[model samples]
Target: MKLSKNFTNPLAANNPVIVQILGICSALAVTVKMEPALVMGLSVTFVCAFSNLIMSLLRNGVPSRIRIIVQLVVIATLVIVVDQFLRAYMYDVSKQLSVYVGLIITNCIVMGRVEAFALGNKPWDAFVDGVANGLGYAFILVLVAFFRELFGSGELFGIEILGDWYTPNALMLFPPMALIIIGCIIWVHRTINKDLQEK
Candidate 1:
């Protein structure tokens, strides 16, 4: 039951992107297109899952004072692996992602799970939590990208979806529009999960 909660809650109740509002930077930056958003999401998921497992495995040996530093090192190493893999096989998407791929080290979702859950949980449980959080974050990114790409360019993954008769809305491509979309998501999320609403 606990493991299921760890796997399920982040999808909505504790979503790192919309509920906890972590990793918003990448959510805004890489979500302009579906392909990049999907890549970015997978990158984050890999880093978060492994980082959590590693940290959980090392939790007992690491000195408390240096834990944060160690966590950064672990996360950075994983991010580097993901970045290089993308550069090697998906050069175009890598270029589209730019520094944001490296920036996964600093994504709140990665470090946040390490500090909050991995430090104390068993390795399997921590891994599941990390995967859940990563997926939750990805869900929002893809959803936002779906709207942005469709409306902004009348395409998905750069392939034309809407007929040319539909004029693309330029504003949908802008960062501010991503913010508004996120705001609407949060509003709707809070409305549905009354527990998240203010008392």
Candidate 2:
């Protein structure tokens, strides 16, 4: 029951991508390849979840005026830790992701949730909400990456699927494609979850 809630909550209702429009920069940029996108997604999940937990723990004593600053320090520390870990163990992927990994510190999704949910919740519940939102953002990201990689490179997870004759579409690799795919996903998501549009 917990796993179901964790994995599925982000895909709709409180979807980080659609409902919140969080983390779209990474959603557009790193999604050119499946493996990289997956890694990016997981990294965001770890940072967001842990940062939420830590922030929730400190919420009570944090000065109301400095709460935003406190949240940034915690989030940045986690991003640096993740960056160092990725560099030491996964250098190639780290290089590909480049500044984007570091930029996670500024990702609105992280800060937005930290301020809105984490500060108000118990530590464990904050963690769950963070993971759920991160995964929800990732779900839309990966789904877009799935199509972009498949059509743009004729591959998924770096495996050729469209045969040799298929010429990959260069346009699909660009950010515009990400925007289009996200638009379509939003359209469909809103259609099914019509309450969002009404709101």
Candidate 3:
């Protein structure tokens, strides 16, 4: 794939969340609010990009029998680093993210790109792909978080947006609402891209 495509495609045409439907767990878990969602998104982006880069660099040297193990190690190391950084600086958000930060190690989006793209592509290309996909994931997360926080809590990033007269929808803060929001996003995306609906 061209470098531009590697960087741009995932933002829309190949979005990990809306298109590929990967990483939905974190999307639902952390998006009850915006701050944790933003933190989680950036942390995942960092992990995905660096892990892909490292995996690409080691692709040729990794023994076929142990490549998956090697990829997990790299991903785990990166996730630990991100977790530690969040703990140190964004302690509250870190606590809010809790296990989900560690769970990034198990995210299919990270593993899939590392195995399917980084293993066969150049390091830079892999890095771009990872970052692009991460951003795609982040974009949907933020979008969902925006609505959830806005309607669920009458706020955005903890700043109150709705007036005292406004009544928040309690259900919007729940996991089922996340699935509904994501479903709506997928519906709109497919509606706009008619080719995506063709079977």
Candidate 4:
């Protein structure tokens, strides 16, 4: 149950990037390419999961007044570690993501999970919360990457999808298109998950 906890939350209701819209800025900015988006997703998942785990371990000792600062410290440390690892190993993807890797420190999703769920839960539950949110964000990031790459570049993971006659639209490569796609996704998702529709 401890391990499973780290894997499920992001798949459902409390998904950091989706239901809460926690990291849309980065989600939109880096999702134009599938490879870069995948790197970002994996990096975030690592940072979020470790941050939650560490934060949960320290939950008992941190004074209420200093909890936020402490959480940031933990998150920043993990983000930097992940960034350096990416630079050393996946240098190509790192170049594409550029400063966005460092910006993960400011990502509300990571900090939100640490503060909201990790702070109150045991280490196991916090790990699960982090994983779930990571998967949740990954799910949408991949989804957005799917459409963006397929149409913007006539490819998915860089393979042609539209065949010979199809012309890729340059607009789809721009960051603003992510907002339109995400809006449509929300529209369709709300239509399907009508229970979430604003009454």
- For residues 1-199, could you state the per-residue lDDT of candidate 3 as single tens digits? 5899889999998899998889999999999999999988888899999999999999999999999999999999999999999999999999999999999999999999999999999999999999998889999999999999999999998899999999999999999999999999999999998888968
lDDT of 3 at 175: 98
Scored by CA lDDT, what does every candidate get?
Answer: 0.94, 0.89, 0.94, 0.85
The residue pairs that clash in candidate 2, if any, are none
Q: Compose the digit string of candidate 1's lDDT tens values, residues 40-60.
A: 998898999999999999999
Quantify how close model 1 is to the true structure by its C-alpha RMSD in Å. 0.7
lDDT by residue (63-86, candidate 2, tens digit) is 999898999999999999999999
RMSD of 2: 1.9
The regions of model 1 sitting more than 4 angstroms off are none
The TM-score, computed over Cα atoms with residue i paired to residue i, of candidate 2 is: 0.94
Q: Candidate 1: TM-score?
A: 0.98
- Candidate 3 yields a Cα-based lDDT of 0.94
Cand. 4 TM to true fold: 0.93
Worst 10 residues of 3 by lDDT: 1-10
